[model samples]
Target: MTETELLLSLIDDKLRKCEDGYMLTHTHFLSLGERSSAMAHLKNRYPNHVFWGGYPDAERSVLFLLPEYMEKDDFSLEDEDDPLCLVRVRASSAKLTHRDYLGALLGLGLERSVIGDILVGEHGAEIIVMKSISDYLIANFEKAGSASLKITVDSIKNLEPPKIKTEFIRESVASLRLDNMLSAVFGVSRSDAVEAISRGMVFLNDTEATKPDARIAEGDKLVLRGRGKAYFREQSGTTRKGRLSVLFEKYI
Candidate 1:
Protein backbone atom coordinates (compact mmCIF):
# COMPACT_ATOMS: atom_id res chain seq x y z
CA MET A 1 0.00 0.00 0.00
CA THR A 2 1.01 3.63 -0.46
CA GLU A 3 2.39 5.61 2.45
CA THR A 4 -0.75 7.73 2.64
CA GLU A 5 -2.91 4.62 2.55
CA LEU A 6 -0.89 3.05 5.33
CA LEU A 7 -1.13 6.21 7.42
CA LEU A 8 -4.87 6.41 6.86
CA SER A 9 -5.24 2.77 7.87
CA LEU A 10 -3.26 3.44 11.03
CA ILE A 11 -5.44 6.44 11.83
CA ASP A 12 -8.54 4.32 11.25
CA ASP A 13 -7.22 1.66 13.61
CA LYS A 14 -6.43 4.27 16.27
CA LEU A 15 -9.89 5.76 15.89
CA ARG A 16 -11.41 2.31 16.21
CA LYS A 17 -9.36 1.63 19.32
CA CYS A 18 -10.48 4.88 20.86
CA GLU A 19 -14.15 4.37 19.92
CA ASP A 20 -14.48 0.66 20.68
CA GLY A 21 -12.14 0.36 23.64
CA TYR A 22 -12.97 3.84 25.01
CA MET A 23 -9.40 4.87 25.74
CA LEU A 24 -6.85 7.37 24.58
CA THR A 25 -4.82 6.28 21.56
CA HIS A 26 -1.90 7.95 19.84
CA THR A 27 0.32 7.44 16.83
CA HIS A 28 4.07 7.65 16.53
CA PHE A 29 5.72 10.99 15.98
CA LEU A 30 4.86 12.34 12.55
CA SER A 31 6.76 14.84 10.41
CA LEU A 32 5.22 18.17 9.47
CA GLY A 33 4.04 16.83 6.12
CA GLU A 34 2.59 13.69 7.66
CA ARG A 35 0.71 15.66 10.30
CA SER A 36 -0.75 17.96 7.68
CA SER A 37 -1.85 15.04 5.55
CA ALA A 38 -3.41 13.26 8.49
CA MET A 39 -5.36 16.34 9.51
CA ALA A 40 -6.57 16.99 5.96
CA HIS A 41 -7.82 13.43 5.72
CA LEU A 42 -9.50 13.31 9.12
CA LYS A 43 -10.88 16.88 9.23
CA ASN A 44 -14.01 17.32 11.41
CA ARG A 45 -14.57 13.54 11.62
CA TYR A 46 -12.66 13.47 14.87
CA PRO A 47 -13.12 16.27 17.37
CA ASN A 48 -11.41 14.80 20.40
CA HIS A 49 -8.06 14.70 18.72
CA VAL A 50 -4.85 16.76 18.93
CA PHE A 51 -1.46 16.94 17.27
CA TRP A 52 1.25 17.33 19.88
CA GLY A 53 4.98 16.69 20.25
CA GLY A 54 5.70 17.49 23.88
CA TYR A 55 5.49 21.19 23.06
CA PRO A 56 3.27 23.73 21.37
CA ASP A 57 5.58 24.73 18.49
CA ALA A 58 6.93 21.26 17.80
CA GLU A 59 7.62 20.62 14.15
CA ARG A 60 7.03 16.91 14.56
CA SER A 61 3.90 15.79 16.40
CA VAL A 62 1.77 12.78 17.27
CA LEU A 63 -1.93 12.48 16.62
CA PHE A 64 -3.95 11.62 19.72
CA LEU A 65 -7.29 9.91 19.26
CA LEU A 66 -9.49 10.40 22.28
CA PRO A 67 -12.62 8.65 23.52
CA GLU A 68 -16.10 10.17 23.37
CA TYR A 69 -15.98 11.39 26.95
CA MET A 70 -12.66 13.22 26.52
CA GLU A 71 -11.73 16.52 24.95
CA LYS A 72 -8.43 17.50 23.37
CA ASP A 73 -7.72 19.81 26.28
CA ASP A 74 -8.08 16.95 28.71
CA PHE A 75 -4.66 15.63 27.71
CA SER A 76 -1.45 17.22 28.93
CA LEU A 77 2.07 16.80 27.65
CA GLU A 78 3.43 17.13 31.16
CA ASP A 79 1.09 14.53 32.69
CA GLU A 80 2.59 11.27 33.89
CA ASP A 81 0.06 9.38 31.81
CA ASP A 82 1.35 10.99 28.63
CA PRO A 83 3.01 8.66 26.16
CA LEU A 84 6.00 10.95 25.61
CA CYS A 85 9.14 11.31 27.75
CA LEU A 86 12.09 13.68 27.78
CA VAL A 87 15.60 12.22 27.61
CA ARG A 88 18.38 14.58 28.55
CA VAL A 89 21.81 13.63 27.21
CA ARG A 90 24.69 15.70 28.46
CA ALA A 91 28.29 15.45 27.31
CA SER A 92 31.51 16.78 28.80
CA SER A 93 32.43 19.48 26.29
CA ALA A 94 32.01 17.99 22.84
CA LYS A 95 29.40 19.82 20.80
CA LEU A 96 27.01 17.50 19.05
CA THR A 97 24.89 18.33 16.07
CA HIS A 98 21.30 17.19 15.48
CA ARG A 99 22.56 14.74 12.89
CA ASP A 100 25.08 13.31 15.33
CA TYR A 101 22.41 12.63 17.95
CA LEU A 102 20.04 11.23 15.34
CA GLY A 103 22.74 9.03 13.90
CA ALA A 104 23.50 7.65 17.33
CA LEU A 105 19.83 6.96 18.04
CA LEU A 106 19.36 5.21 14.70
CA GLY A 107 22.63 3.42 15.34
CA LEU A 108 20.98 2.06 18.47
CA GLY A 109 18.28 0.57 16.19
CA LEU A 110 15.50 2.94 17.20
CA GLU A 111 12.99 3.94 14.57
CA ARG A 112 12.67 7.62 13.60
CA SER A 113 8.97 7.53 14.40
CA VAL A 114 9.74 6.88 18.06
CA ILE A 115 11.89 10.01 18.19
CA GLY A 116 10.48 13.53 18.14
CA ASP A 117 12.63 16.67 18.11
CA ILE A 118 16.36 16.58 18.94
CA LEU A 119 17.27 19.93 20.47
CA VAL A 120 21.03 20.27 20.31
CA GLY A 121 22.86 22.53 22.72
CA GLU A 122 26.45 23.53 23.34
CA HIS A 123 27.06 20.63 25.69
CA GLY A 124 24.58 17.96 24.55
CA ALA A 125 21.03 17.42 23.40
CA GLU A 126 17.51 17.00 24.76
CA ILE A 127 15.39 14.42 22.98
CA ILE A 128 11.65 13.90 23.05
CA VAL A 129 10.80 10.26 22.59
CA MET A 130 8.15 7.64 23.27
CA LYS A 131 7.87 6.61 26.89
CA SER A 132 7.97 2.92 25.98
CA ILE A 133 11.69 3.11 25.17
CA SER A 134 12.71 5.63 27.79
CA ASP A 135 14.24 3.07 30.12
CA TYR A 136 16.01 1.27 27.30
CA LEU A 137 17.55 4.52 26.11
CA ILE A 138 18.69 5.46 29.60
CA ALA A 139 20.41 2.10 29.82
CA ASN A 140 21.84 1.70 26.34
CA PHE A 141 22.21 5.09 24.63
CA GLU A 142 25.85 5.90 25.13
CA LYS A 143 27.59 7.93 22.44
CA ALA A 144 26.58 10.49 19.89
CA GLY A 145 29.19 10.69 17.13
CA SER A 146 32.38 10.75 19.22
CA ALA A 147 30.97 12.34 22.34
CA SER A 148 30.18 10.06 25.27
CA LEU A 149 26.67 10.76 26.51
CA LYS A 150 25.23 10.92 29.97
CA ILE A 151 21.60 9.95 29.72
CA THR A 152 18.79 10.65 32.17
CA VAL A 153 15.05 10.31 31.90
CA ASP A 154 13.13 13.34 33.04
CA SER A 155 9.58 14.65 33.02
CA ILE A 156 8.36 16.32 29.87
CA LYS A 157 8.17 19.53 31.86
CA ASN A 158 11.94 19.44 32.30
CA LEU A 159 12.61 19.48 28.58
CA GLU A 160 14.40 22.75 27.91
CA PRO A 161 14.71 23.15 24.17
CA PRO A 162 17.61 25.17 22.95
CA LYS A 163 16.78 28.82 22.48
CA ILE A 164 16.08 29.59 18.84
CA LYS A 165 18.55 31.92 17.14
CA THR A 166 17.14 34.12 14.44
CA GLU A 167 18.59 36.60 11.95
CA PHE A 168 16.47 39.61 11.19
CA ILE A 169 16.29 40.37 7.46
CA ARG A 170 14.97 43.49 5.80
CA GLU A 171 14.23 43.27 2.08
CA SER A 172 12.04 44.73 -0.59
CA VAL A 173 9.69 42.62 -2.67
CA ALA A 174 7.57 43.77 -5.57
CA SER A 175 4.65 41.75 -4.29
CA LEU A 176 3.59 39.65 -1.33
CA ARG A 177 3.48 36.52 -3.47
CA LEU A 178 4.84 33.42 -1.79
CA ASP A 179 7.61 33.06 -4.36
CA ASN A 180 8.54 36.72 -4.19
CA MET A 181 8.82 36.63 -0.42
CA LEU A 182 10.84 33.42 -0.52
CA SER A 183 13.21 34.95 -3.03
CA ALA A 184 13.80 38.02 -0.90
CA VAL A 185 14.22 36.24 2.43
CA PHE A 186 16.27 33.27 1.24
CA GLY A 187 18.39 35.08 -1.36
CA VAL A 188 17.21 32.76 -4.09
CA SER A 189 16.18 33.70 -7.59
CA ARG A 190 12.48 34.23 -8.19
CA SER A 191 12.42 31.31 -10.63
CA ASP A 192 14.13 29.08 -8.08
CA ALA A 193 11.61 30.02 -5.44
CA VAL A 194 8.76 29.28 -7.83
CA GLU A 195 10.32 25.99 -8.75
CA ALA A 196 10.66 25.05 -5.10
CA ILE A 197 7.04 25.92 -4.46
CA SER A 198 5.88 23.97 -7.50
CA ARG A 199 7.85 20.93 -6.39
CA GLY A 200 6.22 20.96 -2.96
CA MET A 201 9.37 22.05 -1.20
CA VAL A 202 7.72 25.03 0.44
CA PHE A 203 5.34 25.13 3.38
CA LEU A 204 3.34 28.07 4.63
CA ASN A 205 2.21 27.92 8.25
CA ASP A 206 2.82 24.15 8.39
CA THR A 207 0.79 23.39 5.26
CA GLU A 208 2.28 22.52 1.89
CA ALA A 209 2.19 25.57 -0.35
CA THR A 210 1.68 24.64 -3.99
CA LYS A 211 0.88 28.01 -5.47
CA PRO A 212 3.79 30.30 -6.15
CA ASP A 213 1.55 33.34 -6.39
CA ALA A 214 -0.29 32.70 -3.15
CA ARG A 215 -0.46 35.93 -1.19
CA ILE A 216 1.67 35.98 1.94
CA ALA A 217 0.79 38.07 4.98
CA GLU A 218 2.70 39.34 7.99
CA GLY A 219 3.26 36.74 10.75
CA ASP A 220 3.11 33.83 8.29
CA LYS A 221 5.67 31.12 8.81
CA LEU A 222 7.43 29.82 5.72
CA VAL A 223 9.61 26.75 5.40
CA LEU A 224 11.75 25.95 2.40
CA ARG A 225 12.54 22.26 2.62
CA GLY A 226 16.26 22.31 1.97
CA ARG A 227 16.72 25.94 2.94
CA GLY A 228 15.37 26.98 6.34
CA LYS A 229 12.42 28.50 8.18
CA ALA A 230 11.49 32.20 8.18
CA TYR A 231 8.77 34.17 9.91
CA PHE A 232 7.34 37.19 8.11
CA ARG A 233 7.48 39.61 10.98
CA GLU A 234 6.08 42.69 9.32
CA GLN A 235 5.59 44.82 6.25
CA SER A 236 7.49 47.84 7.42
CA GLY A 237 6.56 50.14 4.56
CA THR A 238 6.65 50.65 0.81
CA THR A 239 10.00 51.29 -0.85
CA ARG A 240 10.56 54.28 -3.10
CA LYS A 241 10.38 51.94 -6.09
CA GLY A 242 6.82 50.83 -5.19
CA ARG A 243 8.09 47.59 -3.57
CA LEU A 244 7.00 46.45 -0.13
CA SER A 245 9.67 46.58 2.59
CA VAL A 246 9.42 43.36 4.57
CA LEU A 247 11.04 42.17 7.76
CA PHE A 248 11.68 38.48 8.35
CA GLU A 249 12.97 36.57 11.31
CA LYS A 250 15.02 33.87 9.66
CA TYR A 251 15.98 30.97 11.87
CA ILE A 252 19.73 30.54 11.68
Candidate 2:
Protein backbone atom coordinates (compact mmCIF):
# COMPACT_ATOMS: atom_id res chain seq x y z
CA MET A 1 0.00 0.00 0.00
CA THR A 2 1.00 3.61 -0.50
CA GLU A 3 2.42 5.38 2.58
CA THR A 4 -0.67 7.59 2.88
CA GLU A 5 -3.04 4.62 2.68
CA LEU A 6 -1.04 2.73 5.28
CA LEU A 7 -1.15 5.72 7.57
CA LEU A 8 -4.93 6.29 7.13
CA SER A 9 -5.56 2.63 7.84
CA LEU A 10 -3.53 2.75 11.01
CA ILE A 11 -5.41 5.87 12.14
CA ASP A 12 -8.78 4.27 11.44
CA ASP A 13 -7.73 1.25 13.49
CA LYS A 14 -6.80 3.38 16.48
CA LEU A 15 -9.94 5.50 16.24
CA ARG A 16 -12.07 2.35 16.54
CA LYS A 17 -10.87 1.99 20.16
CA CYS A 18 -12.57 5.05 21.70
CA GLU A 19 -14.10 4.88 25.16
CA ASP A 20 -17.44 3.06 25.27
CA GLY A 21 -19.65 6.12 25.11
CA TYR A 22 -18.81 8.41 22.14
CA MET A 23 -18.82 8.03 18.37
CA LEU A 24 -16.01 9.12 16.02
CA THR A 25 -16.86 12.22 14.00
CA HIS A 26 -14.39 13.67 11.53
CA THR A 27 -14.41 17.27 10.28
CA HIS A 28 -13.40 17.68 6.68
CA PHE A 29 -12.90 20.93 4.76
CA LEU A 30 -12.10 22.40 1.33
CA SER A 31 -11.59 25.82 -0.22
CA LEU A 32 -14.46 27.72 -1.82
CA GLY A 33 -13.18 27.00 -5.31
CA GLU A 34 -13.51 23.25 -4.84
CA ARG A 35 -16.60 23.02 -2.63
CA SER A 36 -19.45 21.84 -4.88
CA SER A 37 -18.18 18.66 -6.45
CA ALA A 38 -16.26 17.85 -3.29
CA MET A 39 -19.49 17.80 -1.29
CA ALA A 40 -21.04 15.42 -3.78
CA HIS A 41 -18.07 13.10 -3.44
CA LEU A 42 -18.21 13.17 0.36
CA LYS A 43 -21.99 12.63 0.46
CA ASN A 44 -21.51 9.36 -1.34
CA ARG A 45 -18.57 8.26 0.84
CA TYR A 46 -19.45 9.31 4.40
CA PRO A 47 -23.18 10.15 4.09
CA ASN A 48 -23.33 10.57 7.87
CA HIS A 49 -21.10 13.60 8.66
CA VAL A 50 -22.77 16.94 9.43
CA PHE A 51 -21.19 20.37 8.83
CA TRP A 52 -21.16 24.04 9.93
CA GLY A 53 -19.67 27.12 8.24
CA GLY A 54 -18.52 30.77 8.47
CA TYR A 55 -16.47 33.53 6.92
CA PRO A 56 -13.39 35.20 8.41
CA ASP A 57 -12.95 38.97 8.45
CA ALA A 58 -12.58 40.48 4.97
CA GLU A 59 -9.09 41.99 5.34
CA ARG A 60 -8.05 38.68 6.82
CA SER A 61 -8.85 36.00 4.25
CA VAL A 62 -10.09 32.60 5.52
CA LEU A 63 -13.13 30.70 6.81
CA PHE A 64 -13.52 28.96 10.15
CA LEU A 65 -16.13 26.79 11.86
CA LEU A 66 -19.20 28.34 13.30
CA PRO A 67 -18.77 28.59 17.13
CA GLU A 68 -15.17 27.52 16.47
CA TYR A 69 -13.29 24.51 17.81
CA MET A 70 -12.79 24.73 21.57
CA GLU A 71 -9.20 24.02 22.45
CA LYS A 72 -8.48 24.12 26.17
CA ASP A 73 -11.40 26.54 26.68
CA ASP A 74 -10.50 28.79 23.74
CA PHE A 75 -11.89 28.80 20.20
CA SER A 76 -9.30 27.75 17.62
CA LEU A 77 -9.00 28.62 13.92
CA GLU A 78 -7.57 25.21 13.00
CA ASP A 79 -8.80 21.69 13.78
CA GLU A 80 -7.27 19.62 16.56
CA ASP A 81 -3.91 17.92 16.01
CA ASP A 82 -3.70 14.47 14.43
CA PRO A 83 -0.91 11.89 14.78
CA LEU A 84 -1.87 8.69 12.98
CA CYS A 85 -1.83 9.75 9.32
CA LEU A 86 -0.83 12.40 6.78
CA VAL A 87 -1.70 13.05 3.15
CA ARG A 88 -1.51 15.92 0.65
CA VAL A 89 -4.46 16.68 -1.61
CA ARG A 90 -4.57 19.27 -4.37
CA ALA A 91 -6.85 22.26 -3.79
CA SER A 92 -7.69 25.43 -5.74
CA SER A 93 -6.40 28.86 -4.73
CA ALA A 94 -8.39 31.59 -2.97
CA LYS A 95 -8.57 33.72 -6.12
CA LEU A 96 -9.73 30.88 -8.29
CA THR A 97 -13.31 30.58 -9.48
CA HIS A 98 -15.70 28.90 -7.04
CA ARG A 99 -16.29 25.21 -7.74
CA ASP A 100 -17.87 22.09 -6.25
CA TYR A 101 -14.71 20.30 -5.13
CA LEU A 102 -14.29 22.53 -2.09
CA GLY A 103 -17.81 22.01 -0.74
CA ALA A 104 -17.30 18.27 -0.97
CA LEU A 105 -14.22 18.35 1.20
CA LEU A 106 -15.49 20.72 3.92
CA GLY A 107 -19.03 19.37 3.69
CA LEU A 108 -20.30 22.97 3.87
CA GLY A 109 -20.73 26.19 1.95
CA LEU A 110 -17.75 28.57 1.83
CA GLU A 111 -16.66 31.88 0.36
CA ARG A 112 -14.51 32.13 -2.76
CA SER A 113 -11.44 33.25 -0.83
CA VAL A 114 -11.25 30.44 1.66
CA ILE A 115 -8.33 27.96 1.62
CA GLY A 116 -8.15 24.38 2.89
CA ASP A 117 -5.61 22.04 4.45
CA ILE A 118 -6.21 18.47 5.60
CA LEU A 119 -4.43 16.58 8.37
CA VAL A 120 -5.18 13.05 9.60
CA GLY A 121 -4.50 11.92 13.17
CA GLU A 122 -4.31 8.73 15.17
CA HIS A 123 -7.99 8.79 16.13
CA GLY A 124 -9.43 11.69 14.12
CA ALA A 125 -8.90 14.15 11.27
CA GLU A 126 -8.68 17.94 11.06
CA ILE A 127 -9.48 20.22 8.16
CA ILE A 128 -7.86 23.65 8.42
CA VAL A 129 -9.13 26.79 6.74
CA MET A 130 -6.71 29.72 6.39
CA LYS A 131 -4.60 31.80 4.02
CA SER A 132 -1.63 29.51 4.49
CA ILE A 133 -1.79 25.85 5.51
CA SER A 134 0.31 24.45 8.31
CA ASP A 135 3.52 22.70 7.30
CA TYR A 136 3.75 20.54 10.39
CA LEU A 137 1.11 18.82 12.57
CA ILE A 138 3.19 16.64 14.87
CA ALA A 139 2.86 18.76 18.02
CA ASN A 140 -0.86 19.64 17.95
CA PHE A 141 -2.55 16.23 17.71
CA GLU A 142 -5.26 15.47 20.27
CA LYS A 143 -7.16 12.28 21.12
CA ALA A 144 -8.87 10.40 18.29
CA GLY A 145 -12.10 8.38 18.05
CA SER A 146 -15.32 9.01 19.91
CA ALA A 147 -17.37 5.95 20.57
CA SER A 148 -21.13 6.45 19.98
CA LEU A 149 -20.50 10.15 19.55
CA LYS A 150 -23.39 12.54 18.90
CA ILE A 151 -22.40 15.42 16.62
CA THR A 152 -23.65 18.98 16.32
CA VAL A 153 -22.46 21.74 13.99
CA ASP A 154 -23.41 25.27 15.01
CA SER A 155 -23.98 28.57 13.17
CA ILE A 156 -21.58 31.51 12.88
CA LYS A 157 -22.47 34.98 14.10
CA ASN A 158 -21.02 38.29 13.03
CA LEU A 159 -18.99 39.61 15.97
CA GLU A 160 -18.00 43.20 15.10
CA PRO A 161 -19.25 45.60 12.47
CA PRO A 162 -16.50 46.44 9.98
CA LYS A 163 -15.08 49.97 9.97
CA ILE A 164 -12.05 52.07 8.98
CA LYS A 165 -10.52 55.19 10.49
CA THR A 166 -8.38 58.00 9.14
CA GLU A 167 -6.41 60.58 11.11
CA PHE A 168 -3.24 62.75 11.27
CA ILE A 169 -0.45 62.32 13.80
CA ARG A 170 1.82 64.99 15.26
CA GLU A 171 5.42 64.98 13.95
CA SER A 172 6.96 63.69 17.20
CA VAL A 173 4.46 60.85 17.55
CA ALA A 174 4.88 60.02 13.88
CA SER A 175 8.51 59.12 14.53
CA LEU A 176 7.51 56.10 16.66
CA ARG A 177 4.85 54.99 14.21
CA LEU A 178 5.21 51.58 12.63
CA ASP A 179 2.04 52.34 10.63
CA ASN A 180 -0.11 55.23 9.43
CA MET A 181 -2.99 56.77 11.42
CA LEU A 182 -5.66 55.16 9.24
CA SER A 183 -4.50 51.60 9.89
CA ALA A 184 -4.21 52.20 13.65
CA VAL A 185 -7.81 53.35 13.77
CA PHE A 186 -9.25 50.55 11.65
CA GLY A 187 -6.94 47.82 12.98
CA VAL A 188 -5.98 46.80 9.45
CA SER A 189 -2.62 46.18 7.84
CA ARG A 190 -0.53 49.27 7.22
CA SER A 191 -0.02 48.41 3.58
CA ASP A 192 -3.75 48.03 2.92
CA ALA A 193 -4.72 51.18 4.78
CA VAL A 194 -2.04 53.10 2.93
CA GLU A 195 -3.37 51.92 -0.39
CA ALA A 196 -6.79 53.17 0.59
CA ILE A 197 -5.33 56.51 1.61
CA SER A 198 -3.46 56.86 -1.68
CA ARG A 199 -6.62 56.14 -3.62
CA GLY A 200 -8.30 59.04 -1.81
CA MET A 201 -10.34 56.49 0.10
CA VAL A 202 -9.64 58.25 3.41
CA PHE A 203 -10.52 61.70 4.71
CA LEU A 204 -9.63 63.68 7.82
CA ASN A 205 -12.59 65.80 8.89
CA ASP A 206 -14.09 66.01 5.37
CA THR A 207 -10.66 66.58 3.78
CA GLU A 208 -8.73 63.79 2.05
CA ALA A 209 -5.73 62.61 4.06
CA THR A 210 -3.57 61.02 1.34
CA LYS A 211 -0.21 60.98 3.03
CA PRO A 212 0.35 58.08 5.39
CA ASP A 213 2.16 60.51 7.76
CA ALA A 214 0.12 63.66 7.87
CA ARG A 215 0.55 65.51 11.17
CA ILE A 216 -2.43 66.79 13.19
CA ALA A 217 -4.01 67.53 16.61
CA GLU A 218 -6.17 65.77 19.23
CA GLY A 219 -9.72 66.56 18.16
CA ASP A 220 -9.57 65.98 14.44
CA LYS A 221 -12.42 63.90 12.96
CA LEU A 222 -11.10 61.43 10.38
CA VAL A 223 -13.31 59.87 7.74
CA LEU A 224 -12.56 57.04 5.41
CA ARG A 225 -15.55 57.07 3.06
CA GLY A 226 -15.32 53.39 2.18
CA ARG A 227 -13.91 52.14 5.48
CA GLY A 228 -16.04 54.04 8.04
CA LYS A 229 -14.78 56.92 10.28
CA ALA A 230 -12.98 57.93 13.51
CA TYR A 231 -11.73 60.78 15.72
CA PHE A 232 -8.34 61.15 17.40
CA ARG A 233 -7.80 61.60 21.14
CA GLU A 234 -4.38 62.25 22.61
CA GLN A 235 -3.70 60.77 26.03
CA SER A 236 -1.12 61.27 28.76
CA GLY A 237 2.19 59.46 28.12
CA THR A 238 5.42 60.32 26.34
CA THR A 239 7.27 58.00 24.00
CA ARG A 240 11.04 57.99 23.36
CA LYS A 241 10.51 60.95 21.06
CA GLY A 242 9.00 62.98 23.88
CA ARG A 243 5.63 62.64 22.14
CA LEU A 244 2.48 61.70 23.98
CA SER A 245 0.66 58.55 22.93
CA VAL A 246 -2.08 59.27 20.37
CA LEU A 247 -5.36 57.41 20.56
CA PHE A 248 -8.19 57.35 18.06
CA GLU A 249 -11.66 55.84 17.94
CA LYS A 250 -13.68 54.66 14.98
CA TYR A 251 -17.15 56.25 15.13
CA ILE A 252 -18.59 52.73 14.94
Q: Tens-digit lDDT track for model 2 on 1-252? A: 963354345434433432222434333333222232333444454333323333332221221122222232343333333211222222222221123333343333333333333333233223434312233222222112212211112112322222334354332244323235666666677788778777656655444455777765677766665566567776557778776576765554
TM-score of decoy 1: 0.91
Highest lDDT among the candidates is held by which one? 1
Error of 2 at 245 (Å): 2.0
> TM-score per candidate, in order?
0.91, 0.29
lDDT of 2: 0.40
The models' CA-based lDDT, in order, is: 0.87, 0.40
- What lDDT tens digits, residue by residue, belong to model 1 across residues 1-252? 998789989999999998999988899999878887788777878867888888777888999987878767676644667888889889865667888899989999999999999887777878999999998898889887777889899888877655778999999999999999999999899999989988878989888888999999889999998799999999977988999999999999
Candidate 2 regions off by >4 Å?
A: 1-179, 239-244
